[model samples]
Target: MRPAPLNPLTRAASLRALARTSPATPLDVLVVGGGVTGAGIALDAASRGLSVGIVEAADWATGTSSRSSKLIHGGLRYLEMLDFPLVAEALKERDLLLTRIAPHLVKPVSFILPFENPLADRVYVGSGVTLYDVMSARVGQKRAVPTHRQLGAAQSQERFPGLAAPYGGIEYYDAQVDDARFTQALVRSAVGLGASAANYARVVDYLREDAPAADEAGAAGGGSDGARVTGARIRDEETGAEVSVHAHATILATGVWTGEQQAAADADTGLEVLASKGIHVTVPRDRIDAPARVGVITRTETSVLFIIPWGELWLIGTTDTPWREDVGLPLVTATDIDRVLEGANAVLERPLTREDVVGSFAGLRPLLQPVDGTGDSARVSREHAVLEVAPGLSAIAGGKFTTYRVMAADAVDFAVRSRFPRSRSRTEDLPLLGADGAQLSASRRSLVLANRDLRAHGWDEARLDRLLSRYGGRLADLFALIDAEPALACPLPGAEHCTAAEVVYAVRAEGALHLEDVLHRRLRLEFEVPDRGVAAAEVAARLVAPVLGWDEDRVAEEVARFTSVVDARLRAEAAETDAGAVEAVAAARPGGGQGRRVRRIARM
Candidate 1:
């Protein structure tokens, strides 16, 4: 049978049903965390015909999942550490995402790993890169990307004129994706497969019995070993309503938040997820005036830094520092920005300064601290671990974003084998929502045309490509709305690449609740453009006002809140010197607005 369509009406009805009807029987699985891993698990379990539901404390990918380096690579640096399995696993998934699963959303991008110390270092790093390419090809994965090649200093300089001279390099291939959109698409696929999911619903506590009740009658089944975690008590963060959801199995994919959830279970899961903050600074394409062809990978003492090309902007980042404060909101500090700029400038002919930074973001990588506690969190394993905290609660942590599918599969495998005992993993060969061949091709052409033709309206090809790449075949769904309402096609006043129609589509179709969702994830105006989408907030709010039933007052309030968020982010970025300082600034920001907004349309 054909799967049901996942549209606005379908999602609304599912939320209503889940809220209204208390399931008489416990669900097969309940996933906590609406990030990539949780969404992947939801899709995996639901596709297998299992009863599944996922609850998130915030909007999808509002956490680390959305704030990432956004690379879908095999972790080339891991090869140097002789972690073959990690590299192999990530490479397989990278191929899957780029070719079979989310072709429209994930595409190949090349990176130039510069070698400052020539001679021995050149041959040594070149050999490692060769292995990386060889292994990728050995898997019989479609060569969606070209192979790597060695470049002399002059040739490398020609490719990336920004590089300071005497830089021999190895050019290799990787993939880039819009992390938030990919996670959202995964949730949508799971919903299409009958999985119930809700963002802003936080699992506050686990329901456990103090003692097992002795059934004198001795029931046919287990006789309620205190019902073995009958369910979880969840608080709807948006509405402040508390409810219980019963499930035979619960999977915790909360990433950095895994520790708190584990503590709530009161079980010695022996798992600890440490937060490692990585900051990325975005600058305009013209700022560097260098060859914008491939990404640049520079070696650092602890981790490698990447100068990635993200559409019209270049994303230079990432400092691997321990985060000691709030894990939920990791902010990019001025110091973090300075560190990245300093690192990139070490290779660039013309060094970058604070003035070149248009925007900055920070995300926490959930690292699995070993029980031995011998090594720092940065050196901790990137491999994922699944532990049964309690009879019904399972927690997974310590993995890279590129391997979310594998982590999801492992979590689902554990849940299925524990609960059903007869089921086997099926997601290894499964495809996401837009992966079908015909739909994928049509989506690509439509995206190209939409971007090319829309130039008359101020959208350049690069902007259109970025949108198409992020949405994949789903671009048509957005354009359909624009076709119905011609005014929706107008570009957001300040955010020229975005249109009023996108905000409406984000709310009506993409499950966007707040202005932040529209600005940050749905449109990416927050990161791609300067002022962090502040100037375009009012126009976006107005565009979605009818759909959300917002009166003039509500629209103005929404706009004000968005502007405050941007202002706070700017202030925080300026005030802090490191990730920790950046987080402090974020802590002081008001409105407690971490995720999506509630949709409230005024009665016409």
Candidate 2:
């Protein structure tokens, strides 16, 4: 059978297409949230040959999905918590990503867990890593990641130049990915399979057979009156336009915003999603004495700290604290910054100070509170829960980035349990858009890549290799755009390691509506620059302005809008408390009409 054409997700085209469906011709599934989980659900449902549409209230992956540590791993710390099943599940997904799913996007990364007491700590950590390897091995006959190995003091320091621990470290394997890009790829792939997706489309209320939802009236169980959710009342943030999307079933993958949606819907999902804020700071790669191959992971008093190597920077972070303020508008406050730096400084020969910090971000984990709701955010379970929020509506919250596919499969399974009897998850061996071609044997891939004409673009073999790793089979898609507009191949003046082609691609293909979306999420200039992408914003904005259909005034408006957020975020980072930070960011965030995609399966 001929599959549907992969039409570009230009903002105008998507909005028009998404607004077409009505109650008479409803979709099979309507997914809320364009993060990793919802994206995975879109693909899962489409692969089952069900008609699906996914909507996001903001930009795709602009929430927790984009702000993660970018690790694809079996939580090593979760092992100490004795969550064997969770560790095992995440390990299985990690391998699937490395070997079968997104090898180009998700690659093997080794971490050095430094030990102060060589004897006791080594034995204890070694056993834990050994178990981690065993769990991984059980999932796959061919090992996708390397096993744990003991490193001597000399070897440890050789791998990571700065070693605060006198004793050696345990070298173990995990994986890392560009989480936002990966989530976008899932949406693109799903769209290729005929699923409908739109961003900047927020669900204002739920659609019921009895009556349309009236601003919650009773967000947990009122107005619903045992009625089934027929669909959702969606608001177009850009135009202040509203539309009703009719679907047989609705799945809410709203992450931390799950609570807000539940309250608004008057549906008791039983699953209580508590927002736990985590912060990460970035420093230039040279700022930390760590090598490219070896990242550092150490035990913090409250949580684990990782000094992971990102392109030209070291991403170190993650303070786990309970948050009571906003849902998606998390800020990296002064205290949060200090907590992460102090944690990383404890295991560094030369400590990092506030001056060395370049960029930082914060994410809210939709931590599932225990039935008793007794433990702190750090101790809460990472396992996900699928709840029957109401008849024809399902909600899911809590899960590791590594195990998003599992959560998606479970959510789809629950949502369609009685509705679609023959439909089953077919995403186990499914490769994302770029993975199939990317999985070519290295030697063959190298030989094939060698034939590309890159002289005009000033790209060498190494640069092309990076392109292959980042785009996989989608290299052709990017090149197609460049071919149409030769100037796009030029390097972006301010943004290092990125080309103007990316900005155009983000709009034409990746559904990026504004300059902020390109600079922050698509190009990642925000996390890579000391000025927080402010300097690069103009060039990127100009490049994407035409594609996004912006005039001089619109371009300037976009740049100013982006700058306001960056300026606000910078101010927020200096604030002492979350409240202060919230006040700072909220002041700049414009909402009269503001931000935010999904999709299908080829292999299934």
Candidate 3:
């Protein structure tokens, strides 16, 4: 089938169509949430020639999806717990992402696991990593990444001179990606395959009863059972307009928000999903004085710590704390940052402080609570579950980021079986939007070098190769637009690696609706920029103004909104407690109604 266009124009039209349907046509599948899993489901079901529509209350990846460690791996630590199946499944998917699915977005990275005792530690960790590599090979997955190797103390020190101890370490491989971009690309790819997807469209309640029927007396009363879900009553956050869209099947992929959606769709389903918070801090590459590496998993008392490399910075994180606080604004508290710094600094010669942290983000993991109430969020299996809560409503949750595709496939399979029994999923071999061979090679160095404008901008073979590797073949399409408008090739005001044209492209082609979306996810300026892209907000907003049809007032508003978010992040970082931090971040978000609701809902 010919790929559908996923540019901004199409997205606007889709949203309009969704808003116009009075009684809403019943769809084959209606996916709530536009994050990675939902996008994946849309792609899976649509590729099978099923009609699919996905609705997100906010922008794509505006939640836990955008905030991740950004690593695509086999969960090396899981091996220690003897969770072989999860590790093996994740490894297979990791390979698929790196080689076949999103080679442009996902690339191999290396990490060093330092040890104080050379002999025992090396033997234990090395065995696990070696087994990890063997499993990847055993799965018939192409080993795009190299195998793990034992490193002597001297060699380890040479690679990471800042190591406190020189006993030795083991180097293992994994992959890194732009998580939000990957999610967007997944949505785009699904759209290209005829899936209907929209953002900022919130599902307030399930349409349980049929519309008033025209019987013998043409009476205005429901015809079907009142309890059975018929569709969803959706609200466009931007316009505050309500509309209903019927569907033959509904799949809830809202991650941490799954339980709430399920209960709204049906009260007696009684699904329990716990939100486990994980925080990541980004420091300048120069701060750590470590080689570009990945998989630096340090064993902790409760969980593992990872000091992974992300683009121009090192992403050190993640505290697996059970947070019962606000889920929507999962702000990284000072305490959380302190914990991460303490864990990561254990082996570092120079410890990282709040001053060294350029950017920090926290994501909530949707863990399924066990019935026995014996397991903690960390121990809850990353294995996903698909539960048919009602006749038309189904909820899927509790999967790791690496295995989103598997989770999506399973969820869609349940939807098909319970709601649309005739449909079959065909996404196993379906390539995403930019997966065509021609598009895959479009951003190659040779092709980029052929462009005179790129050459003029000092894009040598090496630089073009870097761009191609980062953008895959999609870089060609971006460059073509820049060729037509030379001014777009100029680098961002504050960020050197990113160009103004990229910002415009993000708004025009990538569905970037706000400055935060452009800086934080679209180009990663927030992570790469020292000020977290605070200084570049105005410039980025101006670049996207035309595409977004923003007037001067709207442009100023966007800029102000971006600044407020950055300010909130900074304030949250400075807060001493998690509650204060959550309040700070919540106060700065746009649309007071949604932000307050999110904060309240998250706390619940």
Give TM per candidate.
0.89, 0.90, 0.89
What are the per-residue Cα lDDT tens digits for candidate 1 across 301-335? Answer: 66689888877789988899988866755666777
- Candidate 2 at 82: error in angstroms? 2.3
After superposition of all CA atoms, the RMSD between model 2 and the true structure is 5.5
Assess each prediction's global lDDT (C-alpha) against the native.
Answer: 0.74, 0.78, 0.73
* Candidate 1 regions with alpha-carbon error over 4 angstroms: 1-12, 19-24, 139-141, 165-167, 209-227, 290-293, 371-382, 436-455, 459-463, 577-604
lDDT for 489 in candidate 1 is 65
- Segments of candidate 3 deviating more than 4 angstroms: 1-8, 19-25, 138-142, 210-226, 293-295, 371-382, 418-424, 436-447, 458-466, 586-604
Best by lDDT: 2
Evaluated against the true structure, the overall lDDT of model 3 is: 0.73
lDDT of residue 377 for candidate 2:
15
Q: Give candidate 2's error at residue 271 in angstroms.
A: 2.2
Worst 10 residues of 2 by lDDT: 595-604
* Lowest lDDT 10-residue stretch of candidate 1: 595-604
Q: Best candidate, TM-score-wise?
A: 2
Ranking by TM-score: 2, 3, 1
* Residue-wise C-alpha lDDT for candidate 2, range 82-160, written one tens digit per residue: 9998898888899889988898899888999988897998889899999999888853288987788998888888878
Which candidate would rank higher by TM-score, 2 or 3? 2
**lDDT for each residue of candidate 3 in 71-155, tens digit (9 for 90 to 100):** 8989887887899989988998898887777777787888888886878988888889989988889444446789988888788
